[model samples]
Target: MKERRHFIRIVYQAPAQLSQSGAQWSATLKDISLHGILLSCPDGWQPGDDPEFQVDIVLPETDVHLTMTAELVAYDPQSLRMKIVNIDIDSISHLRRLIELNIGDDALLHRELEHLADLAEDE
Candidate 1:
């Protein structure tokens, strides 16, 4: 099996109501991909349990806010890190532009653009 690559960074506040037990916490995203994100939170969370939460990502070097629904896919108690999955495309697009701009690299952006172009060509 081949390993997959991710193309985004997580940077935002943790969702308001994530648990029924009133365990509210905040986290900062370390990296993000279209599929999921790696976040570091103050409290420890468990994997396999779905946590209903929202994430706010400010576009790098800008104030554009991108918010979306995220589910906890995996967790590490020692590291206090978790993997959030099921990010939407709209949020991905917005963050992609910001990453391209702030990072000053168009590789990923170009790849996405080309993918869109290919889809358009097919249509």
Candidate 2:
């Protein structure tokens, strides 16, 4: 199948947490992009009727933690895919820099930032 992703995915594993309905679970980060994230499914997590999640990823060897609210997009037995729906300015800045360093293309990163901004404007 042809690739359908618009954002470049960077593989950066980190410890993460997911929260929903006042409960929290530990999860392992698989990868991330400007638009979404892939994480190992939290133990005992069931989709059911809940689709929104609060996520926090703590970068390894750093004091940085990127937090965002994401909507469940898809999932399988091993992983959960989420689309970033909301993020604060500070978290987004940190995530942007993280992506920039991993992506290694200033122009491409800038274009993606513009697209992200446009998406926010449309919402």
**How would you encode candidate 2's per-residue C-alpha lDDT over 1-123 as one tens digit per residue?**
999888899998999999999989899999999999999998898886889999999999999999999999999989999999998889989999999999899999999989888887998
Clashes found in each candidate (C-alpha, N, C closer than 3 A): 1, 0
Against the reference, the lDDT scores of all candidates come to: 0.53, 0.93
Tens-digit lDDT track of model 1 for 1-123? 875444344344332223324455555556654445566754655443446556665544665556666766556753233344444677667766655665666786677556645755775
lDDT of 1 at 99: 55
Write out the backbone clash pairs for model 1: 8-32
Query: RMSDs, each prediction?
Result: 5.7, 1.1
Give candidate 1's root-mean-square deviation (CA, Å): 5.7
Which pairs clash inside model 2?
A: none
